[model samples]
Target: MKEEVTQNYLEKVKAQIAKLQSFSIVRIPREENIEADYLSKLAIVKEGIIPPNAPIRYLELPSIFALDVQVQAIDYSNSWTGPIVDYITNGTLPDDNVKARQLKI
Candidate 1:
């Protein structure tokens, strides 16, 4: 399940990357970044010292891309959701316009 969640998040990241006109991802050496040293020290401090003004957010769902595992259960064992799931998750659909339109929903 953890792997599934990670993969789902990765797919979302890839989708966002697809929309970029241009971008670059790089790594900075910790030795050259003093902020990294300070942040590491801060992690050793006691927990829950957050200010009341600091907005505390909680996740009700494991992730925004939570899997709909029961989508295949809609028809009582018949696998009608395969097409829709494929369409939504992978952007894959039939070439026919009508079929693609139906899957878009």
Candidate 2:
């Protein structure tokens, strides 16, 4: 019964996608879909549905371009630090004595 319901829902989604003028459907491995699955689980938690355990997997996409220019700029500007050991040894941000300013719109 559950499988039937899921199949029906997937069929409806496919039909709707077909009706769209422009779309690209990309199949990704479960490992590659972890981020989206995590967000969906977070949404479920927000809606008051608690799951048994937190998801353990993570997906990272290094090659795909992001629309956020600020993130891209930060990625380009930052120098690559070797590992967590390097960070623990040397990384430093602004101190509390320095006043932080928020950008105004």
Against the unseen true structure, what C-alpha lDDT does each candidate score? 0.69, 0.52
How much does candidate 1 score in TM-score? Answer: 0.34
Model 1 off-target regions past 4 Å?
26-56, 66-105
**Local accuracy of candidate 2 as per-residue lDDT tens digits, 1-105:** 668766766776687688799988788876788766666677657665655565644436321222333334233224443333333555533233232121110
The root-mean-square deviation over C-alpha atoms between each candidate and the true structure, in angstroms, is 12.7, 17.5
Q: Which ten residues in a row have the lowest lDDT in candidate 1?
A: 68-77
For model 2, give the 10-residue run with minimal summed lDDT: 96-105
User: Which residue pairs in candidate 1 collide?
Assistant: none
TM-score of each: 0.34, 0.27
